[model samples]
Target chain A: MLKFSKSHEWVKEDAAIATIGITDYAQKQLGDIVFIELPQPGAKLQKSEQLGTIESTKTASELYVPLSGEIVEVNSDLVDNPQWINESPYDKGWLVKLKITNHSELNSLMDESTYRELIAKESH
Target chain B: MESRKTPLYQKHLQNKGRIIDFAGWALPLDYGSMLKEAKQVRLNCGLFDASHMGEIEIKGKGAFKFLQKLTPNDISLIAPGQMQYNLFLNTSGGIIDDFMCYYCDESLLCVVNSSNKDKVVSWLRDNKEQGVELIDKSEETALISIQGPSSSRVIARVFGEKIASLDYMFFTKKEIDHRQVLISRSGYTGEDGFEIYIESKDAPYFWDRLIQEGEGFGLISCGLGSRDILRIEAGYPLYGHEINEETNPYEASLGWAVKSNKDFIAKEEIVGIKNKGLKKIRVGFIMDEKALARQGYGLYLGRNKIGEVCSGTFSPNLNKFIGMAYVLSEYAATGKTIEIQIRKKFYKAKIAKYPFVKINTKSKKEV
Candidate 1:
């Protein structure tokens, strides 16, 4: 199941492997994403840690890791083509794959239904 | 903080504008594509609702003389219906606000940024001479800018031969579309354009008509987003970014605007600073790479941090990142090599002359 963070990061996990990317709400606010700084594979990250940076035409924002993990692989394709995040944020724009080190962190994240409500509230 | 709205707020919504709070005003940032809006202005004409900017009316016997003491530029030579770009300076010789002063008979009109409206009003009220009366007319007036290469055609259609005869920095009142309006041949973009000031009640209709009549010429309803890009490409400085309370007009490369003979407010201090020579000065730069040099980004000479970027953008017209920054006067010379630290990576850049885009304008009146 996919869980979301208040900062608009999303992580989908099953067993101990997880895939992460920012939510649609994030991409919209960033506006015309021009550049993305991605983390390298094998980098260790803590829960709520800074992973990389994303810059749009108007502003720049830091992408944060939702849960503690070791990155197994990264979307290097995004380095050359950053617009993928604006085109398909959730499916094809997945930022990183990680070996989950802290499964308990997932319990604190909002589920799909709850995340939709959060987005609705924040949209206003 | 509550966002401020203009008299034409509903009109913006009807045109599908994307609104954002800027300097306390809930202004339209863009309609959709800011790049398209910018190109529309450069290629054709674009109309902008700038009613939120503050307008101050100063009149009476001491009006022009009082302004001589309040601002950095000389206003004594400005004739009626003429406007001059000037700056308000604090006692420390730092810029309080950059504004346009319009000579209207014995009275003068000063237009300032919306964010600094209250502060400017209070300053005028406190420093007002006994014979001068100051009035805040921002609420009663509406400001609109018709800017671009095709702007002359648009204005000619509206005001006929009257607009054609209007000289740059000059204004005249005429009846247009069944309403009395004041039109000035002045603009922020480096293009031939006109700024219209009309009654508050007639704002919506005037805005709608211009947008409609301008449709054939690719007239767009531009917002703040395109305004910034256009101004930056022209190498004009925004108040807070390039000229602030902490930065003086000398450092802003506005020394030419300052009068040596006229004794305006902070004249002594500014003169003293000029004699000593300015340490830091604003300069234009183009990125050696595709990366941007945003506000507050560290400007470097090799590994040493020299200054910070004041305003930056990826100019759609140029298709490259261009910007302005304050560097030590030694590095302010043209062709000086510099580096901007963007997102922890250094991007190579070089100092270039301002107004990267040369505007071909028709102006008979000299500054």
Candidate 2:
């Protein structure tokens, strides 16, 4: 399952586990990514809960969890190479993996087309 | 009110510059990737359209005397063809604006912030002496600033080798397309650069010429976003950030520009403030954590609020998070550990000297 949140985070689910990262639009708005701080693994979080922080050359903003889950792993190598998020935000730039706690939560999120329409309107 | 567009608006759009409303003017925020543009300037060169900056020409025989009363700096220090950094202060010793004053044709050309243009013009009018005249030439003039390490080569290609050899802090006249123009060896980016003045109608032509000539030199069109980072890295004061109506020059660490021997607005109050002491002073800091600290964020020593962050950014050249803040003078020493409140958390940072990255501007020796 692939879905996105209104706050511009994208989540990809596979076998009850989901990987997440910020949308390309969010990265562009933030200018250049410099530092990122993610939550430690094994931490439980609810849908739309605070996830971590993403700092850029322009300013700092908070990352949010798209759906309820428990943090299983984080991209630790990002600490020394934060610009990877700016370079390859979708693939290698994935922020963390979370074990799904509520599968139904994905139904409430927007699919690729709906999210695309939302961003198109929002940008204009 | 409609946002005013500069003469080069079409050029900006053609270059894919992201336009933003800045103080009632439409200006470029970035072409793309502020970091890449900033890094390009550090590594090569970048062309900037600074037409939003105001140029107020102080003309007439009494201009020198009028300026002596208007600015904190000793206006007598500069002569024709030379320039000096200056500040405009109010009666309470508050900084009204910081600008570059160039001496030419027995007049002073003060390049001031776009946001403070009206205020500076009104102040000059209200205090005009009998023989002095103030001409606000901002609307008719276009300022194109080419800055960075390779700026000399690019400028020389556009103008002549004579312009490339112009001494730092000096300006000379040139004729481009039969239009009288001015080129100065001065800029705000803390790099080897030139600021060219030409008729507003001729700006687009020159912009294209520079871009064409700058292709081999790796010059990119930069905007306000990179301009902010570069100034912050240089520890230069923005009108409302490091300086304001409440900030005296001494607090902003700009006393070097103030000449105490002369009589000027707020002179007595400024001297008194220096003699008594300053409560807070501006200092630069490096963040120990990768987190960012923004303007208005609190600076703490233990549990007490010691100061406030003025300007903050991630320096591409240094690969470090750096910022400037006004803190209590007692705790302003370099290497002193402090904490910057970034939202709900506090991150460690330490006081450091400015020009966080070594500056590459041409010095007198380079001239």
Candidate 3:
């Protein structure tokens, strides 16, 4: 099942592992991605903590952890090919694989419909 | 206060430009990818609606002398049809603003940076001598630019060969759609281009004509995002970033703009600063890492902080991250290495000479 955060991060859960990446809406707003800094594997992160940073040609934006978890793996390929995030924010562009530390934290995230409504109001 | 929209506002929407509030003016940041737009300028042509830029007219016989006192550059060096880059320096040797003046023989037309219009106008009036009529025409005038290598070809297709070959820095008055428009062979980008001044009421028509005729030559509309990157790539100093009220001309590596023979504002102070040397010196640097060294970032030599970055960006032409930084005079030298502190980590960068890309401007002498 897919869950989302208000900060534009998306998470797809399978058993206890959740795949995380930014939304297409977020990537579009950023315009272009030039470079990125990802977190190391096995790092313990809490809910709403800064996870990584993405740099566009214009400016840099920090990515925040949507839920508490221990990072299992990160997409290291994005370090050399950051533009891939802009090209595919959902599939190959997945940022980190996290083992959910708190199952109740997933309840705080929004569904697809709720995330769509949030962005729709932001455009106005 | 509400943000002011340029006369080309609707046209920007029609072209699908991503609008942003820049210096209280609603303008296009980019259409989509600023990198793509920047790359296009190097290969072909690009259009820009610069209507938000400020224009001022100095009338009467006192105009020439007023210009002499206002700027550090020698006005007499330029001919009637030519223009020169200039700086408005205060008595303390600080740069109040940077502007360009077109020598019109009868009167001089000055284009000031948009954000500094109010300040520049007040300064001009405060120092107003007799017989000089300082008229601010910024509200009525609109600026449109065609930039890049293919600029001349697109201009030739519409404005004809005579206008296309007008040489760098020179301009001519032409009647377009029964309205008088001023076309100058100049631009912020180092590439060959033309900056056209038209009436605000006629900007849309002017933009449409250029975009339509330019289509055959691969000219696309560009935004301020790419413009900034292009100027920095060419090593041009921006008013707020590389220059400001605190930084003096000599410290900014703009000593060439100051005339030794002519008397102008802050001439004495600038000459003193040049002879006494400066504490800080501005230099351009290319990053050795993928990380960007942004403005206000600290520069380091070993463990000591030496200076700060003023402007930073990724150059599509160079295919690397680059920026301009001000460092201690002792540490500032070409080929010297410095570390930029980003995210609490130090990344190495090499100081290099700029106009990072080869200048493509065609001068009158070259013609």
Candidate 4:
């Protein structure tokens, strides 16, 4: 199951590791993803802080850290192939791998159902 | 997604244009790959649906006098059939919009961006004095642009050899799509191109005919995505990015377009700004790295922040990052060292000459 933040980031957890990327809604709003500046490995992050940046033809946006964690790895392939984020945002588009800083913070995020509802509301 | 169709929307769709909404108007950014479309226009020829943009006809006896007061440029210098690229200014000397004014007989056709249609129309309508009538022909008219190195050959093939004889900034009336049409030798991309104006009903036929006939000459239907990269490479100004209500024309490096001889809207303020000397100027930069420097990215001179990138893109032609920014006047000269902050990391860049690539053309012909 995917957990989502209000800012449109999605995260999937497996034991102690979490994989994260922006939601489909975010990609659609971005139109076409031209470049993405991913966070560096070993960088520490706070909840809701800007983690990286994404650019499209018309605009650019800051990707937010959904929860506090230390980045264990980043999807370096995106540096050369940024369109992967737009193509497979949920799976192969996983932006970063994080070592969870606070386990309880994950509970604050919305599950798939709740996240879908939020997107529906945001569109209106 | 909600798509806003222009007057020539169906025509663009029929011409095999990959349609997309640009600033609420359903327009073709390109018919195919943007890079190939751009190159085709540069090497051979390409046609574009520019009808999504707005065109207002200001006629009546006082049309010229009214425009002189409405625009920042001197309208008196523009003779019949001549056109000039100019800007509209607010009271504070900020750019209201960038536009091209066409002098057609007693009427002047002002072509503007799609997003600024209502705003520009309202501005002109509000300022219309006695003996001047402002007509919004945007919905009734359609525009198409055929551009590239082989543009003359393509135009001569369709509209006749007379089109090849048109001088820069001049337009002529010709028959296209079975209707009387206006063809002008002007374009946004720094290339030899022709802009055709015709009735909306015949736009679809005109677009299809041009694409079908120009296929051998490498004509491609281009979209907004590629257009952005091309214009950015050519170092032209986009309204919201490069020139806006907060930025003055002089600072945007449009001081050459401003006429000092006559008094127009915000002329005194512009003259005052000129006397104080321009504090900042728009300059082009090419990045050394493959990374793109997007709009609002802070530009740095060593460690000090000097300016910010207004527009940037990955030039498909040059296969590198190119951009424009407004740096401090002292660092505005070509070849100055500058750095852009992309994702909080500074990347090295250098201020370069305008038109990242120079387009060669033989345009000695007059209209």
Candidate 5:
């Protein structure tokens, strides 16, 4: 199942583990990604809480967790080559892999179609 | 209150520009990506709609004399058809605004910051002399800047050979597409370019024509986002960030604009401050970490709170985070290490000389 947070982070769930990254719209809005401060593996996070920071040429934005979980893995490649987020946000730009603790927290996030509609409304 | 839109608002909307509220004006933050636009300005050419900037005309028999008294720079340094970077100082020797004063023979044209337009007008009016007339031309005037290394080639292609001979800080009046405009060889990007001032009504058409003609020359439309980054890379100071009513010219490293011999506003205080030397001074620094240092972030030398960042950005050219801060004079030397407290964590940084990227303009020697 694929879900997105209001803050523009997307999560792709496989079994109880989910991979998290910013949406294409979010990367586009942020411009060229220069630096990203990611939470380390084993770090605990709450739903909608600031998990990390993403810095672009213009501004810096806080990255929010879509669901409450413990970080299983982080994309360490982003530290030296942050532009991967801009070049291939969906694939190589995955920020973290989290082992979801609360399955009910997933209900709060919007599904793919709903997130598309939200972004559509926002663009207008 | 609703923000006023520039005449090119529709064009920006059509070009996929992300509109944002900037100093009570609706302006594009960028057309696509600020990083791309900033790179384009450095490598090729970029078009900028600077219509939101304010222009005030001071005309009369005592126009030159009144300007001499108003600005910190020596007004006599620039002749007709030339412009000089100047500062408007308050009674307390603080910066009111930094402007470009254009000497147009009979009248002096003052190009000021959009955010400080109303305040500048009021201040000028209050200090009005008997013969000088202060007229706000901001609403009627529109400014368009074509900036980059290839800017001269693009401008020469459209406007003709006349612009080719125009040196930096020089301006000339010309008619383009049946509209009379003032073309000045000046820009904020620290690049070779031209700033064209035209009537607001002619702006849309002129913008379209430039974009259409400049397409062959690889000129792309840029926005304020890239402009800010470009200026920061060039080590140029913005009004509210590097200077304000509380910050004096000496501390801002703008002492060159103040003519010590001239009898201007806050002359004695400014001269005294210059003689006494600055306690704190503005310096550029590069962060050791990839994380960005932002404005208002505190700068510290160990545990001592020395100063704070004024302007900060991730430089596209340098591929590093660089920023300007007003630090204690003792720690202002190049290569000095400092720490910037960003989001509760202190990041190591070093004071460095700027322009972080080498300036490649036609008048590089002059700068």
Candidate 6:
């Protein structure tokens, strides 16, 4: 199942492991990702805490964790070529894989349908 | 406060430009990808709507004399049809605004930053003497710029052979689409480009016509995001970032615009500041880490904060993080090591000379 945070990060949960990345809407808003600082594997993260940082040509933004977890795997490819985040934010651009420790925290995040509606309202 | 829209606001929306409130004006932050737009200006061509910029006209018998007393540059040196970059300074040698002055024989045109329009106009009017008339033409005029290596060809296609031969820093009045307009060979991007000043009503038409004709040459619409990056790469300073009412031209490395022999506002003070040397000077740097340094970020040597960054970005062309900062004179030398505090981390960096990207501007003088 897919879930999203109000801050624009998306996650896909397969059992206890969740794959995460920024949404397409967030990538479009950021405009041309040049660099991304990804959290290292084994780092413990709290729900809604800063996970990493993403930089475009003009500005930089902090990436936030959607749920409390420990980073299991990080996409190191982004360090050399961050444009993948802009080209394929959901698939090839997945930032990290996390071992979910607080399963109830997922309840606070929006589902795909709710996230779509939120973006639609933001555009208006 | 509500933000005012420019004449091309609708067109920007039509093109899917990301609009943002910039200094009371609703302008495009980017038209899709800001990096792509910035690269277009470096390799191909980019079009920009600069209508938000303010234009002030000074005329009458004492117009020339009045301007000589207004700006720090030697305005008398520029003949009619020539333009000079200048700074409007306060009595203490601080810059109020940096502007371009165009000499039109009978009158002078001053192009200033959009945010400083009211402040500049009021300053000019307050200092107005007998025989000088000041007219604000910002609302009635629209400014457009075609910038890049291919800009000359694009402009030549729309105008004529005359535009191809124009020298840098010179302008001429021409009739385009049956309306009188001022075309100048200058731009904020450190590329060979032309700035077109026309009637506000004709802006939409003018922009559309250029895009249509320049399509063959790869001309694309750019926004403020790309504009900022290009200027930063070129070592050009923005008003609020690199200069302000408290920042003097000397500290900003704009001493060339101040003529020591000329008598103008803050002449005595500025001359003294020059002789005393700058306490802090602006310098460019490339961060060793991947992180981008931003304005107001502290610059440090060990634990001591020496200065602060004014403008910064991840350079698209250089493929690295670069920025400009005002640091103490002792730490302003090329290759001088420094650190920038981004968030809680301090990234290693080194001072370097500006124009981080090589400038490709045309330097041919008119015979």
Q: Interface RMSDs of all predictions?
A: 1.8, 1.4, 0.9, 3.4, 1.6, 1.6
| CA lDDT of every candidate | 0.86, 0.89, 0.90, 0.82, 0.90, 0.91
Higher-TM-score candidate among 1 and 2? 2
Off by over 4 Å in 4: A1-124, B11-18, B361-367
User: Which runs of model 2 end up more than 4 angstroms from their true locations?
Assistant: B364-367
Off by over 4 Å in 3: B364-367
Q: Please provide, for model 4 over B24-108, each residue's C-alpha lDDT reduced to its tens digit, 9 standing for 90 to 100.
A: 8777766544656666667777777778789988999988888888677877777898888888998889888999999898699
TM, every model:
0.87, 0.97, 0.97, 0.78, 0.96, 0.97
Error of 1 at B366 (Å): 4.9
Instruction: Compose the digit string of candidate 1's lDDT tens values, residues B1-367.
Output: 8987887889889988889998878888887657678878888988898998899999999988888889878887677888998988899998888899989876899999987888999989889888999989999899999999888777777668677568888998778878888889888888889999998899988888777778788898989888998999988889888888999888898887898788888899999999999889899999987676789999899888888899988778887678999988887878988889987689899998889898745673445
- Locate the minimum summed-lDDT window of 10 residues in model 4 chain B: B358-367
**Better model by lDDT, 1 or 2?**
2
Candidate 6 wrong stretches, greater than 4 Å: B364-367
Candidate 3: clashing pairs of residues:
none
Error of 3 at B127 (Å): 1.3
For model 3, residues A1-124, the per-residue Cα lDDT tens digits are 6899999999999889989999999998998798888899999999999999998876789999998999999999998788889999998889999999999999999999999999999988
lDDT of 2 at B256: 91
Candidate maximizing lDDT: 6
Q: Candidate 6 — which pairs collide? A: none
For model 5, what is the alpha-carbon lDDT of residue A91?
A: 93
Q: What would the TM-score be for candidate 6 when compared with the true structure? A: 0.97
Q: Between 2 and 3, whose DockQ is larger?
A: 3
lDDT of 6 by residue, A1-124 (tens): 7899999999899999999999999999888888888888999999889999998865789999998999999999999889999999999899999999999888899998999999999988
Question: Best DockQ goes to which candidate?
Answer: 3
lDDT by residue (tens digit), candidate 6, B151-180: 989898888879766889999998877987
Better of 3 and 4 by lDDT: 3
